[model samples]
Target: MAAVKGCQFSASLSGSCYVMRPRLHRFSVKVPFFDGPLRSRLVSLCCHNPNPDSFIVDQTVPLSKNPTHLPDDCPQASASSPSSAIDFLTLCHRLKTTKRKGWINHGIKGPESIADHMYRMALMALIAGDLPGVNRERCIKIAIVHDIAEAIVGDITPSDGVPKAEKSRLEQAALNEMCEILGGGIRAEELKELWEEYENNSSLEANLVKDFDKVEMILQALEYETEHGKVLDEFYLSTAGKIQTEIGKSWAAEIHARRSSRLKNKLN
Candidate 1:
C-alpha cells in the first residue's frame, strides 16, 4: 500500500481489501530528512472525490470516517451526537507544525501531541509501574487525562519556566474547559483529583507517572540524537537533573552512560 498525506490503500488479487497505513509516521528515527507533504497536494490512489464532501475520512490515516476512528472497542458513534465528531486521535496523528522552514518542528514538535503523548504515557505507567505496590491503572488513567487540556492550550513545556502560579492558573482553566465536554460533576471531580495528584506528586503512582513523563522525553531526545548526532545529548542533560524520583534518576544515568558510550563507539 502506498501512503499519501496519511491514508494507505491496497486491493488484492482475489478482490480482497487492505487498509493498513503507517499511522506511526511520527515515530521516525531517520535523518537526512525531507519535507512532509502539503495537505492540499496529497493524492488518494483508487480513492475518488468528485466533490470534496464525498469522502468522509481526512487525507490522513486511522482511515476511519469518524475522526478518532472509534476503536472496535469504543461504542459506535451515533450519527446524531455531534459531540462525538471530535477526532482527538487524528488531531494527534497530524505532525506538529514545523517551527521554522525546516524538517523538524520547533515549539511543540518533538514533544508528542497531547493525546498521543498521554496514550503512550498511560501505557508506560501501566506497564512500567513500580512493582509490588503503586496502582498502575490509576496512574494510567491520570496520565491519559492529564494533558487532554493541552489540545486547547497548546503544549507548555516545563522549560518555558512559566511561573508556577500562572501555570497552575492556566492548567486549572484548561481542565475546567475540558470537563465541559463531559459535563463536569463527580465524574470530572475524579479525573481532576487524579490530575492534582499528579501535579502535586502526592502519591507513589503520581511520582512514578511523572518519571515516565520525563523518561518519554529522554527517549525521544535519544532517538533524535541518534538520527541527528551527539549534539542532541544536551537536551537530555538539561532535563536529567529535574527528575525527582529515584527511578527517574537512575534511568537518567543509564541514558547518559549509554549516550556517552554510543558517542565513543562512533568515534572509535
Candidate 2:
C-alpha cells in the first residue's frame, strides 16, 4: 500500500472529503456514506499509510491556469471555451495558406503548404510498420505538431540566413503563443510537449518523425524534379545518410531508387 502524507480530512453532512497533494498534481477524493463522523475518521486513518506509491493519483490535472480573459487586441475567450477553439483555429489558418519557401524558391508552381506537408507526414506515421517499443500514435501526433509553429514563424530554411538557435527560439515562442491561444489546458500542454520532443529528438517517436520530415522533403523534391524538369540535387544531398531510423532509411531508399530510374530514362 502507498502511504499518503499531509492529507487534509474533513467531514460534511453529505460525505467526507480528502485532499491529496502529489509531487506535481493535486487530487480531490470524496467518499459518501450513510454513517457518521466515525466513518470519516476511519477513512482518514486508512489514508495515513506510509507507502506513497500505493495510492494511484490522477494525472489529468491542468499544468497551468487558463487565462481568464484575452488581451485587448485578441478576441474575448477563456481557456477551454468555445471561442478559444475558434480563435485558435483561426490562427492556424495561416498554416494552410503559407507555401513552403523551398518550393517557392525553386520556382515550383503551386507548392504544398506547411499544413499539407504535416498532413502527409501524419499519414506516413499512420501507415508505418510496427516497430518494437515505438509508439506509432505518438509519432503521428508529433508529425502533426512538428511544423505547427511554422504557421506563425513561416518556413525558415537554411537559405533564410537565420541562425539555427534563432530559428528554434522563434518557433518556440510561436508555439507558446499558439498554446496560450488554445486556452492552456491538457491538450495545449500535450502540444507543447510533443513539439519539444520533436525539436530535441528526445525519444524514439521523435526520431521517427524527424526521419519522416526528411523523407517527406526529398519525396517532394523528386516529384518537383519530375514535374518541372529541374535537378534538385541539393535536397537529396542534404538528406543523404541523415535518416536515423531503419523505416525512414528504407522509405528514402525506395524514393531514391525511383528517382534514379526516372533520371536514367530521361537520358534514354
Candidate 3:
C-alpha cells in the first residue's frame, strides 16, 4: 500500500474488482484488482493541466491547492482582493453628500453632511481632556463610525417616526453590510466593534464619544445660527443642560452664553 500526499482515495467494489477514486483535483482513476492488498502502483497522479480547457467539473469541486492559487481571472482567486474595500469607499461617499436631515427639516440651507459632523466629533475626541484611563484612539474611531450606518438608513431623528429599537436594528444591519463590504478583516472588525460600543453606550470611551456627538451637533447649530441669522432655539433646547461630560458641559455652556448674548444684542 502506497500513500500519496495532496490526494485521497477510496475503494469501491465493482463486479469482482476494486475501484479506487481520487477525492479531488478534478480527475478520477479506476483501478481493477482482486481481493489482495495492492502495492506501490498509485503514483504519478498529477492533475496538472497541459491545456487549460482540459478539465471541467459541473458541481462545486474542492481544489487540490488553496483557492488563492487559482489564476488571476478566477473569482475565488480574487476573494481577498481590495475591490470590496473600494466598494466601501464608494459607500462612504454618501456620508459626505447626505445632509443631516435634522438640520434640513428645520430649513437650514446648505446644512453639514453626516461626514462633516463626524469629522468635528473625531477632532473633539483628539483634543479631549481629562479622560482618565480612557482610550482616545478608540474614542476617535467610535466617533468616525458612530453615524456611519446613517449612510444606509439615513439620519433618524427622534421625531422621524422611527421607533428607537427599529432604528437601532436598521442601523445595525447597515453596519454589518458596510463591514462586509470591507471584506471582514481586522480593521473592519475593529470599526464594527467601535460602532457597536457607541451604539451600546456602555464603555467610558463610548460615553465620552456620545458627549462629543451632542457637543458637535450643538456647536454646528450655533455656527449655523451665527452665520445664517436664523434662531435655532430648538437645537439649543435639545442639548441644553444635558451634556454628560465636563468638557462637553463647558463647551455647551460657552456656546449657550454666546448665543444668549447675540440674542440680547439683537433685541437691543
| lDDT ranking, best first | 2, 3, 1
lDDT of candidate 2 over 1-268, digit per residue (tens): 2223564444332332222333434443333333543322112223433345434432221212432221222121214678888989999999999999999998999999999999999999999999999999999999999999998999999999999999999999999999999887556877898999999999999999999999999999999998899999999999988999999999999999999999999999
Model 2 stretches astray by more than 4 angstroms: 1-79
Better of 1 and 2 by TM-score: 2
TM-score of 3: 0.69
Off by over 4 Å in 3: 1-80
Which RMSD values do the candidates have, in order?
Answer: 18.4, 9.9, 14.2
Please identify which of the two predictions, 2 or 3, would achieve the higher TM-score against the true structure: 2
Instruction: Provide TM-scores for the models.
Output: 0.57, 0.74, 0.69
lDDT of each: 0.54, 0.77, 0.72
Model 2 residue 205 lDDT?
Answer: 96
Which of the numbered candidates is closest to the native, going by highest lDDT? Answer: 2
RMSD of 2: 9.9
Over the stretch 1-268, how does candidate 3's per-residue lDDT look in tens digits?
3223443434332222222222345564433233444211111232333332433333232322223223333323233347887899899999999999989988888999999999999999998785788999888888998999988998899978889999999999999999888886445666777888899998999988998888888888888888888778787788766778888898888887887898899899
TM-score ranking, high to low:
2, 3, 1
